[model samples]
Target chain A: MKKNFKLYISLFLTTLKISAFTFGGGFVIVSLMRKEFVQKRKWLTEQEMLNYTALAQSSPGAVAINTSILVGHHIGGFLGSIVTVLAAALPPLVIISIISLFYNLIRENLIVSYILMGMQAGVAAVLCDVIMGLSASVWRESKTFALAVMILTFLSLALLSINIIFVIVACAVAGVIYFGKIGKKGLKNDLS
Target chain B: MIYLELFWAFFQIGLFSIGGGYAALPLIQQQIVNNYGWLTVSEFADLIIIAESTPGPIALNAATFVGTRVAGFAGAVIATIGFIAPSAVIIALLLFLYNRYKNLKYVNDALRGLRPAVVGFIAAAALTILKLTFFSESAATVGLVNIASLIIFTLALIALRKFKIKPIMVLIGSGILGLVIYGGLSLI
Candidate 1:
């Protein structure tokens, strides 16, 4: 009982700390979470972190909290997942609530506006970095095919201004058609 | 009635907000600003800044902010739950089905295509924010590009990419740079 409680506390606290301190976005918190769980505690392997991060990204909802739930489950079962999620979510809930209360006082301040403006620009660059990393991974698999899809997707969203929902659905359908033929069995053969 | 609309709107956004927080921006902009008129376009842009700088997911922060605006505390609670429900359900399903179904070609293929498309969305989101940050509404008529914002952008990009700084550090550094540039200039 004591050991189980200890595990739960650590899981909760660690998630809380990462969620509270880390800023920018889900992807940024991800690296910190991996360092703590996979590197420091050895609760999960490197491959598992990579797998869950990818899962979190591709799955719906908040990637940071989703990942905490994933790793928490991997560690402490369903109960662990619940604990970790609450821990991950609580800090933000509280922080934003405070900000909401002070919204008017802060919103019109010239200094606050300037800082926010600066942060937005910085965030744009961060998002661009993520794009480069994501594209590189996609390109490494099937260069020409992935490149074509990425270019098409970017242009549609950026220039044509297509609805995001349609863009995602069309890409998913294309994935099913194109990749349905090339299963791992065939992929294995190709590698050899 | 507004609460019900808030619930449904956020629930849909949460369900569809794939590719992480940035992709959620366009959806939130559409629903909250364009669809319901809860916040003006400029207000939505400021909300994005708040959402990004604050902890947690952008969607969660958004749900809370919009909910509070529409219906106070209860609205915040309902909207947050609505936003989280699909994600919780989906993640739980993925967790359970993950090992058994991971290698299926359709699964792999769907992800393969979805992956790049998601990146494209993130890129689009960045461009959108870039426009929001740098271009003023008056720019259409006056063409007043904020030079201070341009300087901050270049400095921030250099700090992030060249020096390999952490994001929080970059944020703080930008704040200081903002105070120095914009604060000083406004006084002039």
Candidate 2:
């Protein structure tokens, strides 16, 4: 019992540190987690971490949160998952809460708006990098089908201005049908 | 009633944000900005800046920020919970099934399909932010272009793609540049 309690506390603290410090996005957090859990603590094997990451990415919600929950579950079961999630979530909650409280004051300031305008451009560039990286990876894996889907989805959303929820659902159904047909054959081809 | 609305809106965001944090941007924009008018387009961009520079998940940060903006501390608590509720339930069930089955062929296949589409979703989001950044107002007209913003965007992109500077650093650099350039202009 004492050992279990210690594990949970360490899990909470490690995740809290990771959540509080890592910047960028979900993938950054995942890599940091790999360093901590697989390399530092030896709590998880490489294969286990990889599997959990893939599952976390595919399942839904914030990948960082999902990955943390899975890691916690592996180490400490349900209670562990809860602890890690709280640890992961608490920083953003507190930080953003403080920011939002001062949001009006910040928004009304001319200098701040100028800074935000500059930051906005930076944000767009970062997002563009993300889009390019994601699309390139998709294009590499599936080629035409993936490219076509990406372009079509972009056009529909950007030009046609369709409701985003509809686009997601349509893609999901399309994915099931398309991938289901390819099935084992596709997997085999990818291995080669 | 407002609390319930916040929960439902964010619950749907949690449930549908399939790819990751970036994937959730469009959904949050649709619900919070477009549907509810909780935030304007420019404010949404600021939220993105804030979410990225700060730690933790972008979706989680956005939920907390938007919630706080709409309803204060309690709303922040509620929205944050609502955003994670689906993730909590879904992940638990997935973990259980994953342990039992040991294979996830169908899930992998669906992800294969969803992955490209998620790229599309994110691209659309980038376009929206880019449009707002570059053009003064309407995208079609391309009315007064913000040359300073364009310069910052180009430099930031080059810095990211070529120099491999961290995004947080790039954001900070851009903000300082903004102060020097824009603040200097205002002085004149």
Candidate 3:
């Protein structure tokens, strides 16, 4: 019982530290987590960490949060998952809160607005790169259906102004039917 | 009433934002910017800047920032919980399923389908921000271009895509560039 308690605390602290320090995004946090759990602590093997990373990427929500949950579950079960998630989420809550309190001051400052305007340009650029990178990977899949879905989705959202939720649901249904028709064999070859 | 709305808005964002953190941007733009009108387009862009620079996932940071702006500390707490609740519950269920069956073919197929759409969502988001940054104000106003912003956009994009510079460094460098160009222009 004592040992279990210690493990939970350590899990919480490790995740909290990672969440607080990492600045890039989900993938950055995932790499740091791989270092901590798979290499440093030896809590998880490389294969297990890889599987969790893949699972987290494919699942949903925040990849960083999802990875933390899976690693927490592995170390401490359900309770462990809860602890790690709280740890993963708490830092942002605190940091953003402090920033928010001074929101007007920052917004109103000429220098700050200028700086943010420049940052906005950079952000737009970064987002463009993200789109290019992601689309290239999807294109590499070489699935006609996938390419069609990507193009149609962009048209619907950008031109037609369709609700994003509807597009997501429609694509999900289309995927299930298409993949289901292909059955187990196609699934293995296509995805794996 | 506002609290309820905030919770509901973020809850929906959390539930539907499949893929990852970037996937949440379109949803946040829809619900928070378009639907609720809590933030203007410029403010939305600023929020993204803040979220990217801060630690933690972009979705969580955006939620906290928006919530605090909308209500107060309590609002921040509610919004953050709403944003994370779906992931916590879904991940817990997924963990159980993984341990029990060890295979999630259906889920995998669903994700496979969702991947292209996610790319689309991200592209749309980039377009929105790009239009605002390059053309100024709305997309319809194409005549009034912010040449400085366009210059920064081109340089930053090249730095990120070709040179493979870190995003944080690019952001910082652009801020300095903006200050020098825009600030100097203001003086003249």
Candidate 4:
């Protein structure tokens, strides 16, 4: 732990730079971080990365922050988590604050507005990719019933304008039931 | 009064919206457009447009824009802070717990289950965003044949997938088209 202090600092800095440069949120940043941490530094295995990502997601923090903390703690103990999460979070937090302040005037300007509109279209495209990407993943991993739940959730909230809380509650119940069934079957199979 | 309510509403949005920026959109849209009437759906649409193109996360950008629209500078700060507060507080708490447990099996299992669920949630949110973008209610308000935007979108996707053109380029190029086309159309 102590020997790799320089390596950890470098990793922290690299993650920070990537976070600052990437304009999008967690998913894009996650990809960038994975490239740096996994492919470049050989710090974490792909399986480790996936495990950390899952932990980061379920935990209460921003996925980006959570991931940084996980990597930080894994490498350098408590202090490492602090340093990395700040490094990851600080860039976006500062940039967003500035953007938030001037955004109105920017929104009103014609050239800026048009550019924004174009970006809006681009956002939609990016989201389309996200949908396509996740669509395949969901189909592959999720049980068919679970996929049905997901599709229904999407249609209800996204398309028909149903209340989101209702959607969340419905999904939570479905998840609990699905897991309950799986847990019971696993236990039964073991008994046999 | 209304703006204050809007402020608190967005604060709640920021608080509850977990997973990522996209997750917050449906709730934010509901509160602002349908419930509070702080913005029209088209204005909200425009906000989404502006939010994506600019720097930072979309949810925070929405908070800033909607906050400003509802009130002023102060409103913007309040809303921005409000949106971030929940996650910030939650993160702080998680950091505290993480130090103690470090590694736990059930914690790991729950997280594994959660990953797929989050994928579901994000996919659902993405679908909602697409509807907000393309399948709009009133077609007249959108520019001349949104298919142009759609084409640009499709081309940009292909560029990203096949050619490996960076998203920033797509963003800038499409923005230029928006400027030229909308600017040109406004004149005519």
Q: Write the residue-wise lDDT of candidate 3 on B1-188 in tens digits.
A: 99999999999998899988788898999999999999898888888888888889999998899999999988888998898788778877777788798888888878888988899898888889988888874222346887888889899999999999988899998888878777777786
* Top DockQ hit: 2
Q: Model 4, range A112-145, lDDT digits (tens) per residue?
A: 8666665667766766665566567756766685
Give the poorly placed runs of model 2, Cα more than 4 Å off.
A184-192, B137-143
CAPRI-style class, candidate 2: high
Q: After superposition, how far is residue A2 of candidate 2 from its true place, in Å?
A: 3.1
The better candidate by lDDT, 1 or 4, is 1
Task: List, for all models, the DockQ compared with the true complex.
Answer: 0.62, 0.81, 0.78, 0.36
Best by lDDT: 2
CAPRI quality band, candidate 1 = medium
Better of 2 and 3 by DockQ: 2
DockQ of 1: 0.62
DockQ ranking, high to low: 2, 3, 1, 4
Tens digit of per-residue lDDT, candidate 1, span A80-134? 9899888987776777777777887897887787676667666666666667778
Winner of 2 and 4 under TM-score = 2
Pairs that collide, model 3: none
lDDT string for model 2 (A63-152, tens) is 999999999989898899899999999999999999999989988998998788888889999998888888889999889889888998
**CAPRI grade of model 4:** acceptable
**lDDT of candidates 1 onward, in order:** 0.79, 0.88, 0.87, 0.65
> Can you write out model 1's per-residue Cα lDDT over B24-109, one digit (the tens) per residue?
87778767876899988667766776776777888888888888878887888788878877888888877667887874455557
What are the runs in model 3 whose C-alpha is more than 4 Å off?
A: A183-192, B137-143
Error of 3 at B182 (Å): 0.6
Can you write out model 4's per-residue Cα lDDT over B56-100, one digit (the tens) per residue? 566666776777666765676677656655655655565566557
